[model samples]
Target chain A: MMTRTFLVALIGLSMGSFGWADNPNKPDDNTTPPSAETSVSPLPTITGGLVFNSTFTPGTQSYSPVVNPIVLVPLGNRFLFESEYNVNSDLTRDHGAWNPRQLNREIEYMQLDYMVNPHLTIVVGRVFTPFGIYIERYHPEWIRDLQVAPIIFGISHQQSMGAELRGAVHLNSKVDLTYTGFYAFNSTINYFTGDRGLGGRTSLFFPEKGVEAGFSYNRRLGDNRFNLYAFDGTWNMKSIPLDLRTEVFKTGMLGNGYWVEGAYRLNKHSHNSFLRKSQVVLRGEQYFTPSAADMAMTSMSGMMMGDNFLPDQNTTRGFAGWNYWVSDAVKLSFAFGRSFALGENQNIYSLGITYRFATGGSEK
Target chain B: MKSTLAIAFLTSLLMAVPAAAGNPSKTPHSHEIDGEAAYKANCTRCHIAIHTYSARSERTMISHMRVRANLTKDEADAIFQYMAGEQKPKAAPTHTAKGAAIP
Candidate 1:
């Protein structure tokens, strides 16, 4: 079944590309004069590409493959349409619960973006929540040192139906304010309820001499509201033997919860040759959540509880991971850690490969 | 509908109240919560402060450590309050006047 669907999509893409390149002007444009076609503007074009990911879990001897192909259709100079479908194979038998094993299931993201101006724009539809770097771009081969994400940010927060406005207002060569405001409907599958949410965020950066610091915040309101506050600082020195970039962030979740992370790339630039991609990424983190007496009672009973009614439990964890990039589009990563009283000792490893192609419009 | 609207308005007001005073640059510190001692007693078993070095995003850092530490949201807030006190302001660097350097 999946194979037939893939073939159909592949044929549609081939035919669409052929039509786009052959005519340059599409047949659907009514504005084009039936008699004087020369004066008519060109019709939008559609371009497509593919992304395939295969992973091998050494411990379990399991193999999982995911393919996410994208089709981009230009609406005009100021607008474009994007559609991507992610299909994957099963890996549940080998791994425990929470395994990302959606076999041939297709999840999609479609977006309509209007360029309000050069520095600002509005996007609506199935949108990516721009909470952090990884959540925004968690495709195969894009992120290094991957473990779906930590519970604080990764599991609890995600993308959904929404609209967002974002832009960077430059003050000078070295200073700019980047801002985004968004609203989303609760995800039926991932969220606690089907309520709607709204959030706004802003950041400031100085990028001229390799020193950058920024602050960001997001407040999501729905049936259960979640809020985040963050501060980030990074420095890059290119004159050293190897290019180096180091960054640190302090973030808070909910009303009072917070955590900190720091990363340093020592050999970031020396990989001019085949071995140059072997930069070292070292990172560490500490986070804890205390258990409330009410939560203890609720857990003890194992019954349904409201969001604000659960007893809070305290937990903390620390982990380290490494990424070895074999090429610009391929990498191998591994991370291991032990949590305190939670008893969630686990190790994760992943290998990924990617390829990218461009056609009429800019890459999403 | 009226009640729902009232509840939403009240919740929005509550959420707004925290943001006004919680800006990191605007506010320097948080008061200590009672859960700090409970966190140290229970969470130190596996999670420690040095764990912050292992993550790139603050959300990832906290979420990853939260599971291991067996912490709840309120408990997590308490520990965060403790860490807020530990945060040190970056010291101004001592500088010697350089002849050719531009200010």
Candidate 2:
């Protein structure tokens, strides 16, 4: 607890250096040098949402509560302070007497963004790892189609601590290129451990068609040869309310997998009731577990390769679901999945509800 | 300087209480959102702000966004116009192409 307190105090001290809170309405701080571009801006706002998921498989039931919050604080014209908090809980009940409940609360990301120019923005602190489209796009429960994450999403290097340079350049009206490259140092403060690595992702986005495909690669500094790569594609049809997304990932030693998912809105601009605000989702995936020898050779390898998650065997999973919009902020989703493996096949079912809300950021 | 910092910290802490406990908005129904509001909700979360594109660029970008974000044609147009610096909604243009997705 003391450690947490100290960390909070440290954050306070850092914010004070920017003088954002002290003089929230002060004219640009020009008297002394400023860490970021100076601006007299509105109060930094808070945004995020609460998500809850429940899953049932045979005799067991699990309820997961996810509270993810994001804070956006603009320090000045050039610098912005942003932080995301993730607090999760799992309540489980089994026929057996021993049921373990787990709670994890950590800072998912906190960073300062410096807009160097139209072509680049510099970031310092912990930032989301630009591995695949999922990490940056669909990982948030509020934005995802289904309640349960893909099996392959477990090993995604979610975040890193260090500096990143990212931005986009529009070559012409028809096409634009976006890029992110970073070098992060390894550190552990509290429950969160930063992955020290060097890597970047580059993608060409078609702004007019609402489609972009890109590739990502990362190498851990600890082990030079420990590399990961991902290729992703996204398409949103302009004629119809349909979106298709696919990603292929290969982690040097953690194994490899690919998943394709699609979401379709039933009706657009129609005055119908439920059908107007409804959406259907479908997903299929294949994963190949790393060889035992490969797992043993890698640094993040775990003991017992074939125990669960099909460490050795090839596995295929398919899921289908639907989402109903109760209101703008609240929605209901139900999904069912079947895992095909060598031995006993398992079925998974999930029903989840998510609510989203935000404050401030009303400025132009 | 120290006093200013303290006040700032206290003020931020106080502001957080309401946001954490209270609802800023309900899930926004289509009618509840407008061109600017829809643009803010859809575009701001990912990038800091929308980049200014020419009318043609905006139309294409909106077409892609319409599919990706599951936006109606009107919603996409609003965003396009917003990026084109059109704050107020206007009547449909009469010269739209026969098969153009944007009205």
Write candidate 1's Cα lDDT for A135-188 as tens digits: 332222333234324434432244557665554443443454455555566556
TM-score of 1: 0.52
Model 1 chain A: lowest-lDDT 10 consecutive positions: A29-38
Worst 10 residues of 2 chain A by lDDT: A30-39
Model 2 vs. true fold: TM: 0.70
At residue A14, give the lDDT of candidate 2. Answer: 39
Per-residue CA lDDT of candidate 2, range B10-78, in tens? 334323322221221321222223556555444532321112323443343344334323333334445
Candidate 1 wrong stretches, greater than 4 Å: A1-63, A93-101, A104-108, A137-140, A145-148, A155-157, A185-194, A233-237, A240-274, A290-325, A334-341, A353-364, B1-103
Distance from true location, Cα of A13 in model 2, Å:
29
* Index of the highest-DockQ prediction: 2
Residue-wise lDDT of candidate 1 within B73-95, one digit each (tens)? 23334443333334311111110
lDDT of 2 by residue, A1-364 (tens): 3223334543443344333222335443211222121112324555566888999887778898888887766555446677878898888888644377888787878887764432345578887777777776677676778887776676563678876655544444455455666666778776446756666676777745767888887765554346778998988666776778888988857788999998877756455777765778999998887777777776444322211233366789899999876655567899999988789478989999887655542223
lDDT of 1 at A7: 35
True contacts kept of 2: 0.00
Model 1 superposed RMSD (Cα): 19.1
Candidate 2: CAPRI quality band = incorrect
